[model samples]
Target chain A: MAVTGMQAELTLGPIPFHWSREEKRDFYARIADEAPVATVYLGEVICSKRAPFFETEIPETAERLERGGKRVVLSSLAEVMLTRERKATADLADMDGVEIEINNAAGLLARAGRPHRVGPFMNAYNEDAIAWLARGGATHVCLPAELPGEAIAVAARAAAALGVEVEYQVFGRAPLAVSARCYHARAHGRTKDNCQFVCEEDADGMPLATRDGRPFLRVNGIQTLSESYVCLVGEAGALAKAGVGHLRLMPQAVDMVGVARAFRDCLDGRKDPAEAEAELVGLCPGTRFSNGFYHGVAGYRKIAADAAAMADR
Target chain B: MTQAELVCPAGTPAALRTAVDAGADAVYCGFRNATNARNFPGLNFTPEELAEAVAYAHRGGAKVLLALNTYPPAGKTALWREAAETGARLGVDAFIVADMGVADHVARTHPGTRLHLSVQAAASSPEAIRYYCESFGVRRVVLPRILTIPEIRAIRKEIPCEIETFVFGNHGLMVEGRCSLTNYVTGQSTNMDGVCSPASDVEYVRSADGSMSSCLGGVTIDRFAPDEKAGYPTICKGRYLAPHRAEGYYAFEEPVSLNLARMLPELVAAGVHAFKIEGRQRSKSYVRSVVSAFRRAVDDIRAGVAPDLADLVALTEGQKETQGAFRTKKWR
Candidate 1:
């Protein structure tokens, strides 16, 4: 790969991990100043109860991100429909100067006849659903993390035909699911009502190991994520060829800006995807990277085969 | 009003017959695929078995609902579509689906076949329920276990579809159809792949303190003492360690059963159309006993008699049960 003008648009996905109000504000404030990401998704996507903590800071943070030259989008709760939660999401949809991302169909109902981005939580598996959302005023759609490349390519073509930007999770541990119950709290021996906000203790997420004692997953509050961070650095070429417009890197506890910059560098041809993977490893030590899901294999297969080769050596 | 419908889960034809004989109004089963949430191996029905089960249910005057509740994996959608077509051809009373794609497919391809939105769809709100009714013609929405009675009443007013609430069995606290924690650790999604913390990935190891730890996909989801009874290895109900807590505990949900038999009247009063009992993988004796008890309770309610809520206690998870979200938001 040679240096060129290619640019990998970075999207900051909604923070899946729960944090205190101050911690969340501080994270976004730092992201506003430092992250090379393009969009900042603000909302509590996991449990509806956590929304009250930082719901007030969302507008200010969206403004701050906008002020920092980043496009900011307020996201609807992925699992909406509770009375208070629905009202909260409705109020968020009513927020001004902020584009909204419809994580669930509730967003479509809330933002009826308004433009919004379709969040990855909504299943847009085929062109029909993608086109349906687009017709319903979706300008951008982040494809689900579980989608293989074939589906992505088809979705990209559909999105392009409808003049919508298609995004993929190019980094971070993929958010696998959101639940009404808090896994972390239950793990901590508490029910969701009395969870004591145990999720705040883990900055990134609590790493989960397989029965054989291998790291396989991470549980953060009600949301569960893959243990291995999905590194699409090696798939940049394939992504570009597939017409994916934006690469989303979920915000982690560490150097997200550097991670974004590395992806940017790789996309710009200043470094190889291999170089980007090396930097990603150095930036987030002890983390494993995999892109096997993109190639329609296991989610934990690393595209950079040399690391596995290195282990053999 | 007619006596409330007693919806039961049938893991096999024998269980279906057992439930029907025990006073089940309708029996629900799933084809052996990711389309249904109970994709447990050796469970569920094959095409021939499902055809046989449907015939048996109909002959016995019990309606059969085929579950195609899991989200269809991308690019492998034909499997779900085929399941839907086969279900319709077999003359199932309805198709219980969770995914929008699967629902859409069934609604369009088999217009005469009734569609019930699976709880796995997570359509918990009136607005969401309305969307399903309008878009895919969802006839009934199986309410997730996280709703209060008031929430159910509110939904009743907003949607045109009938509401089915879970009254017994596994009282899951998580949003249905959307959870992936099990798949993250076990390489299978409960909603899409229909397996959660699959047995192949589960391990039971004896700890140093004479306690046994239950592991899922090589990770300790929870542990129990030598005298303590361990629940099945599902990640959500597993105990984990946190910084503030010294002892590892239940990290997802308390190991409990959703035995809302006591709240039957309240749910029926709240415009609920049916009551569901959850355990399909259970033994036939368990099904016969639970179904008969609920049947008596429901009959008592119809006859204006206050039924005693004992005897069912033995079937409760950990010998304990709660009304769950039907009581209060604070009920844990």
Candidate 2:
């Protein structure tokens, strides 16, 4: 059932970048005090080597967010390759009084029979997979970023029928792939084990450019992300109408609180879609925005909402 | 010590026969459709071809593993289901699957059928492997090409099912089944359509300065000098410039093939049950040479003798090879 006004919830996804412990704490502190998102996902979803740096700060951050009337969920790694990572995932599953989001299958195995959320990294492409995950105690599922609009609508409908909430990534650089070999270390001519944690230097990520000088992708240690940010402020109403329960906003090195407000204004119909797009561009200046994956085109192509509307007419 | 089975690729009936004749313990092939990962045109077997291949492998005491590994799109799962049913009817030795729905279908509908989890599932941990073993009765899991021998040994001790690792062919450093870089450029995805950098959209351009470049979907992926060997235009192996770096380099991975011929003994000693060779789209002669070389290496290890390392650098992608995360976790 689609409500008339602001029915879809705004969720802040876990930070995929390698931010320092203090920086992470400060970001969440700002988010808790200011951002209008309903849920805040915490914990390291990228490299496990960076986990201990912020291990002590996770609880405090989650507590602060909960105190701010926001629901907190601990997110697991997108890829579990080492033994310690597996143990850490199992430990996350064993935690009490906190919801968990399983990004990989190891999390599902560790947290089976318990209500949890499935992150975008775990493939929930088809209805059968969605129903299977729901039966295994998944309360929420985020569709992958590459899914077209029609597939998203179908998956959202399937989730509704299975009594599961469906979430979609609406902002930031889409995480394309993750690997065990650290690209940041490789780019710096260091190995993953002795890399000296070089990824911390790049707050957002190491921007990769094509040979011809076009910015193509960002190498964030083990994860590769798009150079363009996925902005769907204009599609919030259509997404909500298609039964999407939440729009996940990925963290970037920008004014995320302002970004959240822009999305909220657009979703609530307080700002015109075109104006919201312009405001988003102004907020994150010099960032390329794309929603072509949602439009069944190349992911880098930015299809203007006004142009689409006029074409339909 | 149990000799690790040699699992080889077979894109056609001829390749299947060559692999079996060359001493592959099991040959994996897929039907001619998007239901399988190697869904390229002029590749893969039809149902009748698969039935004959299965029979031929059975006669030679080799196994036929049907690969139905692609993730079916939402509301379009009947194709995968039909693939599984057809594979079962043709008496495939096992069904290699990646999607949970396909695994569930094979496990429920075809009871007593052997299920091997494809590497596309990206299950690396003991908990993840055990979960599949517990839920779908998966007998084997093709491990992602991202783990070291020591890590695989640790996992083998903890999980319940058998382990399979790639010993040769394309080093897909990116996490399998989770990558969308190809889809971002080409609108077709490996998970959804079993295609990555589809041949239809690939282009090779020769510059006037005696240099060549490979392009995928009109985006230049990599440039090679006349003296250098150019590789397939996969996005991961592309050379790119970064702000932190001055010159262009492979930001993700270099164009190299995984050659674990020297690490076969260690992998076998680590309790790995199978060694997979990655190229189903290759020619029959390529299959024969690789399968035969690995077969001798596996046999030599089992016989307590050193494996005579065959020179396969010429057959490698970009004429380069690496151990690739098997000897160490730091190979980028």
Candidate 3:
């Protein structure tokens, strides 16, 4: 598994949480100065109302990351339901220079024939979807994490023929779902329109525990995410073998710089994957690890590597 | 205004006939495989069943639309392709597709065929709808359960294809074709597997306190009191503990059904070409009642008569309903 000559490029996905302008600038500033990531995605991929809060900081942040020698990709809202959201996507689509990562079909349609990246929200499940996206000027695709490794390999093979880059998320809480209604605001007894930015309270995500009092999921604004962070450091070699060129790390509340360093070490074969996994558990305190979606099991369930590796085959 | 088409769901061949005989203008059904959205056990039509279904629907002046709406896995598109080819051969009226790959295959192989975009595609904007129409020559698109009447009207003015909207049954607040909440807890996906919180993994337990609890993959989704009605533990509709509430909260949504009978006139005026009732996972009776209720309502709207949709609450989940995001954003 450690034998693949292809070094996995680590990319930072957009921060899903509703972080303040100062916190986001500081985070990106540190990411620029310290992180080992090759690419960084910026923009509001969740609620459109949150876009104004940090829209001004995106260019400055993108310039900062670019100055740090990382490619910057601007992302669109995942659920483009409102009229304002549609306008925002059209505006983003009209922008030139930086590549846009389309999360919703509205963005994809708006940016037709333009070089862009397909975010995981687009649901490129199979080779056919990849081919379709590639034909529509998609240069790269971050596949839905619900897909198993074999599926990824098959998609990668299809994508390889079409000359499209494939990205697999190796870290962070897998974004499970996006709804029209804001669950974060709903939980706080408010509506999507008048929620008063209550989502800012949960920097990581609001935990959604089961009736039995077990943490099952997390809510960040309108999105529902898996409770466990997808820690695929143990399977980086397996993913690379599956023709995955880039391994994406979603920006979590954890120390992403250290997280990237540990994955970079594992991918470079300097540190064992198991050691990196252990290192990540220590680095991100109070976080549970899961890689079951990689193994074709319940995404929140962490399976043993022997079973996981076998399942990938 | 002209009477809009009354679209209905058909989980089985019986449901198809029931909806047609009960006055559905169009009936949508999927194969018994994952190619369709409602891939539940003991539901959906076989290829042979689809042939008879087409014949029956055609005889009754109702159309049969095949729902090839689920995404096929990489290296596993044969099923979806075969389903579309088979449906085309069976003389089905149209193919309701979600995945672009499936849409591409349908457009190329079955030329001059009707293609309706499934809500599972989650194409919420006019530009997105136009993209599908331009790329695949889509005839219609089932609008996702997210937009308001104004948004729908505004979207209608921009796209070339006809617009269909959900009027009754399960209110999926989560955008279809993109949701993976069930996949996280059960490894079963709505977009891929066409099953959410799949029946195979579902369990119900009763406690000594005369309370009932529903779980999926051994994780408790929701609990019910002795006299409280327990709805199916569709993960999004279930209750969960959040710091905002000590007892619990319906973080995503409560177990409420979307009954937009009151908004039919507005929807029709908003340029809705079809009104879809979503309950293929439900029984034939549910199909019959919902389709007929909506049928009369659509007719009443056309006749300038107020609809009598009060009895519809009996057919809803937990016998509770809401206008959802269609009436107001405050429902969010």
Candidate 4:
């Protein structure tokens, strides 16, 4: 069995950076109203501390998304779980009707006694892990950002056979790592315990540089993301051919609605991928684009020929 | 009750020889490929060179573990598989693997070849370690450096594998083998590619007032005063701004050393089988000096002598060392 895009699906990936409660509420409200996404994921996927500010805002936000005709899925924290974190994950699992995206093994176990969607953070690289998740009641699984196209195809086939929807990150900076030490905390002369909500200052995260003055990475509290925007606009055909079922675009600070529309147009065959790529590239600030990870190359390498070939197809 | 083995890191063949000669019970090195986490230029052994190095170490009564720990890129299993096969053929002690796929491949193809789980696997709990042991026949696990002595003792009681703990060199609290923080900016991952903030991407620029800013791939990692020593330019170890603070500070960990030289007896008592020294990127002389010091310490501990840990200060990070997360959890 192989997956196919029977439904033109768009999943709003969890916000990778911290924002004010008002900002988060407004962001989701806009996504529910203006975006073309079919599903929206809410909750902190980066830092566990940032969850408190928005904890009360989630139910109303989930209701907003549901009212706007989008499916809402709450995400679990990604790394460095403590007892409190384990309890929070369990609480998320107990939420009725709101689908939970299991990001860590703890979350997987918490949501195991019931049906849920596995988030991108969990490593589902092989058939065995995928089958395990399937048996444990995972209805959908987002593939890891580092997986190339061939592996995606294999996993997509396997997920389809198991009757689970497969999703991939189509836009936004790919989440690279989750850490115990908050980079945001360290940057501000504080430890993770006293981070003082410093990460909220960088709406899109603080840009990190290599020693030689290269724009290398971004530090968003405990979460780290790739500097390059993982553009899959060019890989729509390969992904479609590979039987990918849905595209997940992470919410960025600016022009996100336009980014969503561009992806929507491209996925629906209403726009050329090259045109979509050009539009999406123009929308971002001070960032380059790459999809080399999909083709099994250095992630920053923008293979124009590959993009052009995918476009030609 | 054997003396805890001293496992050292060797980035080059010279370092390999230096480590073995300095009395390391085992030295771990990587092939000059993505198979190892330190895939920097001018480091790691070539396949031909690794065979010779392994033979030299084995003849010297020391073991060599080949690190083939990076995750295999999709449809590109051959490179990792080749590294595993080459390590086995060269009679290396073990294949240090982080990826489950590579571990499975090595275990299936080289049945008798020993397999040690890399810390990059981030198996911190007993259940996590037990999963590896039950599934892949993992003989040992280089545990992540975040656990305290009590936590280590607790996990040791439950897992089936021998626990190898880091005793010296650089320390990180981030989830090992799973961290892509380096890849977020530089397009290289220490886990997937075995390279983090690749040296080619690093640049140090002097600022006015005798201060300097270290950059990795064009982003400022940390700025330092002229009198202050510059640390390595990885993203997590950098200084940044936060509220309730006057200026940028080390957000993750400060430039510190992991010197468990003083805690050898405690670690051994906690059921650790091996003490690992973690600087594969250092000089051969550094390897010789560190391994020699730790070797005496371990031997003296085994012979019921109090280990002298004073000489280790000069080799530590920032000329300061801490027992790190090994002794206490509150260090955070």
TM-score of each: 0.89, 0.96, 0.97, 0.82
* Native contacts retained, all candidates in order: 0.28, 0.73, 0.85, 0.23
Report every candidate's CA lDDT.
Answer: 0.78, 0.88, 0.88, 0.78
- Evaluate chain B of model 3: give its TM-score: 0.95
DockQ scores of the candidates: 0.37, 0.73, 0.82, 0.26
Give the per-prediction TM-score of chain B: 0.96, 0.96, 0.95, 0.96
Off by over 4 Å in 2: A1-5, A306-313, B311-318
**Of candidates 4 and 2, the better by lDDT:** 2
True-vs-predicted CA distance for residue B214, candidate 2, Å: 1.8
TM score of chain A per candidate: 0.92, 0.97, 0.97, 0.94
DockQ-based CAPRI category assigned to the predicted complex of candidate 4: acceptable
Measured by DockQ, the strongest candidate is 3
Interface RMSD of each: 3.4, 1.2, 1.0, 4.4
Residue A275's lDDT in candidate 3: 88
lDDT tens per residue, model 3, A197-261: 99999999999898888988989998988889999998888778778888999999989999999
Q: How displaced is residue A311 in candidate 4, in Å? A: 10
| TM-score between candidate 4 and the true structure | 0.82
TM-score of 1: 0.89
Question: Candidate 1: where are CA atoms >4 Å away?
Answer: A1-8, A17-34, A47-60, A94-98, A157-164, A182-202, A205-219, A225-228, A286-313, B1-3, B206-211
